[model samples]
Target: MEFRGRQTQKCPRCGGKALINQYKCPDCGLIFAKLDMATNKAASQRYKNREKSAIVFVKKVPIDLKRWKLILYTVLFGLFGAQYFYTKRWWWGLCYILGFTLLSVCVIFNAPLLNIWDGGLISFFGLIVGVYGVCWMFDIFKVCLGKFKIPVSLPKNELNAVILSKEED
Candidate 1:
């Protein structure tokens, strides 16, 4: 009798073994049709002929976020946490509102400024408010420079469509 090895395929992502007829990876659940076997030639194209495209196209992804609105919120309503609320960051917006409220209470009660050891709660509130202001200022700069991180997300189907279209090119 002749010896023969079992026919199997290895998943490129997880290196898991599957029957040769299998269309999807059992371990990672990656479909064989979606697998990208192309070399770095696609990525290397960005580096060649860098003069014209480098300034306008390279490294820039088209996202749904608007820089003008973000900058406007950061500059105009930053003290009220408007930017965070606009960006859908509820927890950060709540924190900013709470900080503002605490600062307001401290001011109303005239909490001691120089009495640090004697329960000068105003100082703590002031520090928090100051830090909040500094963060708001930093966010203004980041939004202007197009470096602010937004939490927006694309639908999975749309994302997959974009990926498949790029692969077709």
Candidate 2:
């Protein structure tokens, strides 16, 4: 795509029109780069293809600025919410007390009415069922937000190479 503003600054590499966002130049040839979103690593994170957290990723083109920020913020919020629900076990512990007490009372009062009155069995059941329900809900919320974060970093070598390849994406 055409870059904005005047054709003042020349590519540090090619010394051509310098119209590109990045470029590279050698005595042999010149290259220029176009910022495209598909090539961006941040945008790719929406797919979680990253093998490591420290690995760098970039988008060829920056996306809608405000929208990208919102997606990132929302994903962070979702992560924290999921962590709180899954880990901070204070609330869940209380539920354990209430559930066991209720089950014990039902068994004691009605004898044969509740077949699963064994204490170990009932607590195991509550823990698994409760964890499953919460995890399921948290996953659903995160999946609904969709794509986000087209982050790009200008690498020195690639930026220089762009001067020679200065074609639009």
Candidate 3:
């Protein structure tokens, strides 16, 4: 028998090699037919249930979050990350607050704005202001476009459940 051209597959659980025409894993005795049933019947059913629930309970923004309010926060207090806080992104809000504070401190200390004329554009003050400005503008743009990614969890209630008896064809 020529073994060189025979097709083979890897065992999922045991990571052992097996011929594609074989029924069970040679090393782990895992039945390929049972594995197929488990994946197709149970796993795919679960994924379909999840997908249906995801579509039914879809919310563009977080709970109690108004689009107008988010836009207002981004326009007015986005430099300090008020919009991020409202969207429940705490770490990002903290970063914005920290950047604003740093900028304020630099201004208080009368730090020079730029060293571009001195052939040293890599200086301190202007970089922080420039980056902060760009981020603030980008956040406002995203808020306006209604495309900001809000991290909110869907309610795990019966309303979001895909009742097996009521499932459609």
Cα lDDT of model 2 by residue, 1-169, tens digit = 3546655445323344544333432332433333332133333342354333222222122443343443443345332333222222224335544544554554465434335464565556556556644643554453344322134423223332333344555
lDDT of 3: 0.60
Clashes of 1: 0
The total of clashing pairs for model 3 equals: 0
lDDT of each: 0.56, 0.38, 0.60
- Arrange candidates, best lDDT first: 3, 1, 2
Clashes of each: 0, 22, 0
lDDT of 1 at 131: 90
lDDT for each residue of candidate 3 in 75-159, tens digit (9 for 90 to 100): 9999899988876566789989988987786666552533323524334655877798799999899889876766432233222
User: lDDT by residue for model 1 over 64-130, one digit each (tens)?
Assistant: 3456776788899887788777665567889888877877777776645446446566567778888
Once fitted onto the true fold, the runs of candidate 1 whose alpha carbons sit more than 4 angstroms away are 1-63, 111-119, 158-169
Q: What are the TM-scores, per candidate, against the unseen true structure?
A: 0.53, 0.25, 0.52
Error of 3 at 61 (Å): 1.9
Clashing pairs in 1: none
